[model samples]
Target: MEFWIIVALTSVIVTLAVAWPLLRAPKKSTELTDDYDMRVYRDQLSEVDHDLARGVLSEEEAKQVRTEVSRRVLAADASASTSAAEIRIDSSRKTNLTALAVMAVFLLGGASGTYYLIGSAGTADQPLAQRLSALQTARDNRLSQKEVETRVGNITEMEDKATDDYKKLVAKLREAVKQRPDDLRGLNFLVQNEARLGRFAAAHQAKSRAITISGSKATGTDYTDLAELMIIAAGGYVSPEAEAALAQAFAKDPEDPRARYYSGLDLAQNGRADIAYKVWINLLDEGPEDAPWIAPIRGQIADVALMAGIRLAPPPPLAGPTADQIKNAANMSEKDRRKLINGMVRQLSERLASGGGTADEWARLIRAYGVLGETEKAKKIWGEAKLKFASNAKGLGLIKEAATSAGVAD
Candidate 1:
């Protein structure tokens, strides 16, 4: 009977010990009072001020003495407040708690030993499930702690690697551009780095060289990428060339949303509100059917239309792709495409010369020069085009002629 009682008591104690941690509120020491020393210092400061005003010291001596006292008071105040409240509370309370806890542990241990020696001669077996549950809980806690540590370490390593690689890439790009001043690839890399670092103006300057290199033969990818970067660099300020490039790229691959959308933006930037409106109208009419780009394109078209004083109806149903549209104008029988493109160039140039050109029109002139391989002349004309035609009606009309010429079906 004694042994049975002992076993029951042992089980109860074991159960309580296991249950205590789960049921107990976490132990937290109270926050400590801040600035006890500051309170004393403040009292001392009041005393010094009183003494000074009462003529206990001459004014000059009081001033000097007050300065030194003030310094000491502030130092004492800072010292009292610097340690965190939580740390101070833990230091003060843990000492007392530790002593009581040690006493309780020894008492409990003694009672357990006495019961085992005198009251129960046989071992009290625990259920396998309970024992397994305890073991699993302990294992899970250890694994969770280890996993957190591992993940933190990995994140730290990744951060260090990223920083180092970024620096190396920047250095390599600079060196490459310096070695080969005309290297578009190097300039592109530098531009990419500048953009990443948010040095947008610098990126634009670097990207300009790449744009010049791309010239008339700029691939669709090249034109689109450069235009996007240029806008970001300028915080959306663009020249006629940027808009023209965007338009030409769209004419080549109307299916590309980014090219089509930014082409409208470029037009608006260079002060060709009318042509921009029309370009957007065409974009909305001709863009990929049911594409995500349609809404924004429509929105931009509406805005530009408002500015251009052009009331646009809903865009017309898109015409199906024509063979002329699909065939590369550049690849056409050299005689045929060249004749068409040349006729466009001559007719547009004459029109612009008769009056002036729009930003879009200027872009068309540049495109004509690019297609004709007269890059330097194209450049000279583009530079002068904008300054000459701020808002002349003839200038915009000329630009419309240029657009029609450059964007003609193969």
Candidate 2:
């Protein structure tokens, strides 16, 4: 009602402003101009008479001047009469009342009609505080891990297509872990296999047990892994349980890349895109290109940036293992593959040691050694990287991610 009142008042004011001039009586400008000309010509005629009387002009010259002035006076009188007739005719005609009425109607009615058709006529204003409060409420009421898992049923659609041999192997691993619950190695193996089989709930349970067994020795990576598994189990939702695990991971290591990435995701999910954009952008800048979290961050950061009202250029593609290399590794015998990977790792290590590669390269080397089960080598390279990038915060962050993945950093 208030909106309509304001709109109606504005339309009326604008219409009156525009139509005010047209609504007034027309001016007698033509008549006034003719009258002034007639008066001037009459004065000229009188001057001609005076000149004749003062002997300043010949009789014939005076007569000629008088005739010319008289003719001009007559012409002015005729013009004034014509102008008066035109004015009388104009007065007889109708005023612009109809046109003014049409204008007012168009201005008021057209605006109201258009607004009624397209505008949010009855909606209330959503102030910033209200919007933020609503988002906070949504975040508070978001589904829990179990609830989300229940909503996203049949999480193993793809895993159900696994070959008989793979299924049997996973079953055997599950039984082994069940029998040797305290064996961290078996538990780790069970978590990996369960995740591969799309049994993320089981994987997270195994990971939780592993974290409990390690107790004070558990790293941020361990908690991050558990959080990641919970997210996967919930079909990518960062549920409350997953958020708690992520909080634990952050408590362990603030710069843990996986934990930080998931934290950003949680923020984004909860409608805090501004903070999420900053978090993800820092992660992108401080990156080992092959970090597991890097790909997803790259994929979604542009959208998050838009939500945060930032215009972000798409990041350059990351350099990583090629499809052909991955396919080749899949075909290689385990021994041969290990030899190939070891050769590659040796080359990278030598290059970094001799040429002092970028932080990304140093981080990659650390991750590679970790994957090769060379914890001592990974730790040594991590130490060297920390010294090499001592003053560089971004470089140190990247190196820390690799170190975390390699179990060489807290």
Candidate 3:
């Protein structure tokens, strides 16, 4: 009610200001008809008489000058009378009260209607400090990894799709790790196989053990892997435990993509979509298209941008294998699929070597070599990327993230 009252008052004040000129009586024309001009003509007539007395002008000349001055005086008087009559007529004319009313109504009604339609009518004012406090409270109250997992149910269904040989291998690996619990290599293998089989809880446990064993030698990737498994286990929720792991990853390497992506997720879930949107948008723009986080970031970024009060367009699709080509590869033999992948990798490598592609493309090449178990090539590419982006901190960060994922970064 108070808001409406203030708005009404303001509108009235503005309307009065705008209409004030038209509301008052018009001033009489003050130009050319004042007594000053008549005085000047009278002085000219006196000058004519003085000139005649001093014999400077003939009698005929004096008579002619006086006649001209008198004629001008009469003409000016007539113009002044006509102007006064027009002024009187104007003053007597009625004001356009209807137009004034319409203007006032439009100003008030238009503004009120616009506010009612789009403004938050009756919602309590939320100051910056209050909003920040609320976000902090939400963060403090967020669900833990265990709680989220319970809500989403167990995520071990991928084990059903494992082949018999793969299952036997994973089972043997698990036993091997059980027998030699302190062996980091065995633990790492167990974590990979468990995650492949969709036993994310077990995978994260194994990864945590490996990180503990490695201690000071553990890379950011180790903590990132642990966080990734936890998030997967919790059905994509970045739990408190996962956030802690991501923090550890950042402590090791601030450029770690997995850690950065998960941290952004945590921020978004805790009601800081503005910050999250910046993080995710940068990650998407600087992507090695095959980064594990790319697909998920792409999927959620549009919605996140909207939440942050941004109208972002979806990024153009990255150049890659088409749907038809991917479908064809699915039916190919393992060797054939590997050959196709190798061909694609070779093309990217050649492009980067000859044409000097973007930092993201270079990163993609390094990560692809890592995927193919060509660590030597990945390391060489990582070295070249460092030199190429020597002066560019952001580009180096992006490339370093891929190198870390490829096990080639220092």
Candidate 4:
């Protein structure tokens, strides 16, 4: 109320300031000049002199006429000279007043029109507390039930045939996981390798089993894995099961990059770019730095940001894994290989949570985890990888292969 009052008062003051100049009548038009009349009297005196010189009038008569004419000329000059200056000043004042009137009309009309069309002319300000609550509500509403139902992801079933050697390796790995069903690593690997081979149902099964084994110890990432596998198994749709899994993951950690990214992506897919933009912005602000999702978010945000009435700048390009880092694990001993592989996988998981990476890189990272039986991590990678490579036929194929090799073949 106070703020509005101030705005109203300022507008009034400006209007009056403009109107005052135009409303007041200028000083009365300057008295008419006598300069022309004075010139006429002088001409009469000259005529009298010429007549006398031509002997058309006697000297006495000529003298009287000349004196009268001279006196009239002097009177005319005195009066007109005094008034001329006043006329100019009066004209100038009227011109200035006219200008002010034109400006005032434009100013008042423009301000009023703009306020009527776009300004919050009569609304009260929302208090900070209320505003914050509204913001949270809006952000939470970004992922709607309708959206969850309508925007079943671009879940394509992988149908690529595996090579003979990889198929043999996969068969052996599956047997190993089956022999030791309690083996967390085996279950994890089974999920990825099965997924890569397009065994989506198997992948989902392995993921659920992995989660069950973790039981009370399961983390946000754990549920995220199962939810992702559910999405894949459902042909890119976020099924009720997948949505339930996502809810669990979000409940565990709202700021988890994977949850945030997928939630925003879901909103975007459902034609709620406005909500998605806000979700991504919040994710950018609160998620871990240099997370993988940042890259993809940066790539996808421009259109959504525009819809959301926000400006977006490109986030700094992420530096990808070094050639040696990607290859070093191959030559490492079992313990060293596990440590490097996990480190890279964790980094990739976090980075990708926001979204960015090539198909090959995504494939490699998913494969790394699939080999290690970290079904949960491979599931996260597979969920986002499908989105990232949706447009790239070759890349998508590579991802499918890696998903199968990792046992996440769905």
Question: Whose lDDT is greatest here?
Answer: 3
Ranked candidates, highest lDDT first: 3, 2, 4, 1
lDDT of 3 by residue, 20-63 (tens): 76677555555447878888998999899899999999999999
Between candidates 2 and 4, which one is better according to lDDT? 2
Weakest 10 consecutive residues, lDDT, candidate 4? 152-161
lDDT for predicted candidate 2 compared with the true structure: 0.81
Q: Write the per-residue lDDT of candidate 2 for residues 209-303, one digit (tens) a residue.
A: 99999999999999999998998777667898999999999999998988998899899888899999999889878877766666566546666
- Which sequence of candidate numbers ranks them by TM-score, best first? 2, 3, 4, 1
Candidate 4's residue-wise lDDT over 1-410, tens digit each? 67657766887799788677566654544466645676678778888889999999999999888888878777777667767767776787778777877786778677767877898856768997887687656655544333543445323444344577887888999899878989998998888888787666678778889989988888899888777666555544455466678888998887678877777765665556788898898877775666766766654566567766777665555566689876876788989977876776787666655456556667888898888888877876786677655434566788899999888867
Clashes of each: 0, 0, 0, 39
Instruction: For candidate 4, report its TM-score.
Output: 0.47
Query: CA lDDT of 139 in candidate 4?
Result: 56
Q: After the best TM-score superposition of candidate 2, give how far the Cα of residue 196 lies from its true spot, in angstroms.
A: 1.6
Candidate with top TM-score is: 2
Off by over 4 Å in 1: 1-168, 182-184, 211-217, 241-260, 269-274, 289-299, 308-410
- Per-candidate RMSD, Å: 34.1, 13.3, 13.1, 12.3
Please give the CA lDDT of all the candidate structures. 0.59, 0.81, 0.81, 0.72
